[model samples]
Target: MTDDPTPGTRCRACGGAAGTVVLDLGEQPPWDRMPARDAPLPDPAAPLRMWLCAGCGLAQLQTDAAVAEELHGVEPLAMTEQSDRSVGRLARAGLVRPGGRVAEFGSPHGGSWLPRLTGRGMVALDADAVSAAGRADLVVDFYGLLHEPDQADALARRVALLAPGGTLALQLLSLGTVLRDDQWFDLRHGHYGYWSLPALDAALRRHGLGVHRAWWYPLSGGTVLVTARAGAEPDAGTRRLVDEERALAVTEPSGFARLQAAADDTHLLLDWLVAERAAGRTVAAYGAASRAVPLVCRAGLDASLLAAVGDASPAKQGHRMPGSDVPVVSPDELAGLHPDRVLLFLPELLDEVRAALPQVEASGGRWVVLGPGPRAVEPVSALSGC
Candidate 1:
């Protein structure tokens, strides 16, 4: 079959060709809300294709032609939950125990662990660190236009500057994890090299550093955190971690087949909804921004079949659903309008949705869920008024 040209056509992790279909998210404009309301409404860029690689099991968007160049100097993209939790975990793990000087590479704006590390007597480095005014307990500033040689040299410098027994925590993305689980969505253009565990371990050893501990942490879908110290004996944890990684397969061709089977069952419920719509029934949806919405929308239910999208987040309430442009409203708004059918977006958030179902039922609405299968017509007993 001729390969479809898509946003993530090139595997973001290892830069290999992404193969096979994992999901088709349909068209969705940028999921991340623009920084300002007036930030010229980005031209609609939805209906994207997401793929899973058979070779490494990485999941990614298929045709992101404009991403690389436009992404340079984009700092806010660095704000990831992976960095925050990793830094926090390491800080409490005696990595920066009192009086220990530390160094971090690619530490953007010294976000997450840097400020605390500075307080704990550690220094940071970045492009600005080379300036006389750039001195700190830590000193990492942009090296400007980095190559592997530059990275190796800078890391060596940082290691040399560390106080003896002090630790170094480098939080670069791990290609090993991306390959291990095919979490290609975690790969963005900002990062250059895709560091594998063996490759990174070898580099650290060359720089006269020893891996203290390393483990794959699910910070951003998936990531790896490595804590190292200069000249320390290799940690036993590294070997165990590698063995475990090699044991896992990135892709399960059978799993997607199973998911498809489940999806096929879901179509039956969608057919029921269509029949009801043809008979002129009203239905509303709960949990608009969820991935489930795309699946539901793709199933072909019309606007009248899904009256409006309802969400608890005030941030999303008035916004529009990605591809469908279905208007989003509040859960309370659903109660006021009292649509006859309520399709739950997050079936896992069922308890919460169930608890709120009474208000809908009291106002003459019936509950329905398009889940592993679709069924309807009852308020959950969990809520008081139900």
Candidate 2:
């Protein structure tokens, strides 16, 4: 609320002035806001950065640039597919009990594991039905923790909602993967904290929950579904996850400068787009995701280098991406255009999108994966002959 964000001295989780700046991405608009097609470019960009809390070993946004308005997006087919596979893994692992009470904390963007729970014979409860605390056998929050402004309070509530021996299932972006993979863009306004199992173990223990078990997945760069229960200790599997994190030295503040280095690579995407343009190849992009905003804006992209972007969500189609003039179109329209190259913003969704837009390849267009490098990862055609 001041001219600049407070020099973040205190840890968001532990309330200790025991942290240091790790990454700093200069002034950026609220990435979540998609402006009206004719609206002015995003204004009043503020400093975007991440900090490492030595006290709790948590990585967090130093301060919020602005209060964000939720941008509704259709849950990608890949996310949906991951949800099914994750829940099925939980059931097979015996973490899910038959006919138990299930409570969910869905992301603001909207998606829930309740339907999957109900299919597993568990009873799903609405938010109001959950206030009689500690009643749930399973309290699930996938991709929900980072959105919370108050990390301490959020953890407390998720803990309080659990019954004795209840499993609080959390799917978090594994900090080890973030640092090791150079996914620096994950640092953004509105994302409060990044969790390593070590830091999270400290935070959860404060709330009477202990890390119990974990499962890793290659979604969203990398993700982990960690189970925490009251009075539990780090089980054998949990210890292994923690040990892997230690090997990466993720909790150290200086090691985090790697992200600052990645941020300096903003020109990478623009270079690829320019090459495509020189070849007279018309280019479009897919996914108007929040993470794509910083990358697109930082690279100084416009409708010229990157043409229209296709999104599955109707709410976003008529709007332009914030800070740029690129129009958002529907998926059907995206494939129909048969662009020479369609840059996919979210690499983790590569498979699902390939199947969804088979026409792009059938007509001689190749789908290019956008990331550290814009490379054609799939065969010339993914689904055509199959």
Candidate 3:
């Protein structure tokens, strides 16, 4: 990765001067660069700093350099169940109709919600192809805008692709929820910007779009779903959410203080992990999600502290973590390997992992989850492990 011309200098949304530095994650490798077992790893690391825009109150990553040409190189784990649920929710909210033309942006192969548009006409396109895809009744940009360098321009393109009064659905990580919980795992190199309800509403309103409906899903830690239409006005619910976010001090300096404090405490947790390993206690990790690359690096965890990182996705198995030599193994091997304790990278997928590795607990193994706070470690009971 090349150095950003103006590192930690400007906001991507409003182009304002860099605001308060809420959380500095130090230097981290690009999260998506998973190298093959025999391939040499990339040495470049960029500063992962989150800045709050004073002008628009938008929280964004300060790295202006593009890490990779494409965000995702392979297909992500399919969330068919969640897709089905979202389809139902949209239908109930009257955003999906029988014959409506729908376009899904940033959808990976085999993981798209396009199948849900059974009777509707649907097309799936990457961020760059939206201009050529023409118009649609519903444009769904799932987890796309967060990685955009110029959010205003990207959103303007989305608006151009939407038919008059058509719905534009954006599924993104909720900065309000992430900040409130102090979840640093959501802060990674791949995301260029984070959006709160107010910031998103503000951006949409600039394009003559208004929030029509919104929902929050607890999946992937926490995600916000907002559906907007061209001429619609911001509803009372939208205003209420904006007020609540403001009350949480989403853009204030104190909010950054809380995050900085949590980050400070994370180092203590890393110290504890190192101590545990020195005591001859075996420690491994579950899930090799891309976000884990930065978390593991920031925590100073290496192959020495962790035995191996296990992931269920075949795409990631047999690969080495980008900046480290830690091996990514199949989750099935966890029970057989039988580490004394396994640190879960994705807390949201804990139950699924427990079900898959029932014998890990039965054999006196433990699971550790880092969370809502830096030092917040919730150890799963040996009895409830399965």
Candidate 1 Cα errors over 4 Å, as ranges: 1-8, 21-47, 53-56, 65-249, 252-255, 259-266, 275-281, 290-293, 351-358, 361-370, 375-386
Task: Encode model 2's per-residue lDDT on 50-167: one tens digit a residue.
Answer: 8777677888888766756777899987788889988987798676777788888878877889888898788886644676653788889979999988899888888777877788
Query: For model 3, what is the error of residue 276's alpha carbon versus the real structure, in angstroms, after optimal superposition?
Result: 2.3
Among all candidates shown, the one with the greatest lDDT: 2
- Per residue, candidate 1 scores C-alpha lDDT tens digits across 1-386 of 12445534555444456476544444444433312222343335544454555544544445442221211211222234445566566767756555544444553222455665667665545532444434323322221112232345555666665544556566555555544433332322222244555545655677777666776665433456766666655567778775565454224333333333443354676777788788777778776533444454446554556777777666666555544545677778877667877777545455556565567766666677653456774565434454
Clashes of each: 30, 0, 0
Candidate 3 lDDT by residue in tens digits, 197-289: 878878788889977777767777667778988676666876777677788877765665677666666676578678878899887888787
lDDT of 3: 0.72
Q: List the pairs of residues colliding in candidate 3.
A: none
RMSD (CA, angstroms), candidate 3: 4.0
Q: Best candidate per TM-score, number?
A: 2
Instruction: List CA RMSD, all candidates.
Output: 8.5, 2.9, 4.0
- lDDT values, one for every candidate: 0.51, 0.82, 0.72
The residue-level lDDT of candidate 3 at 43 comes to 53
In candidate 2 the C-alpha lDDT for residue 143 amounts to: 90
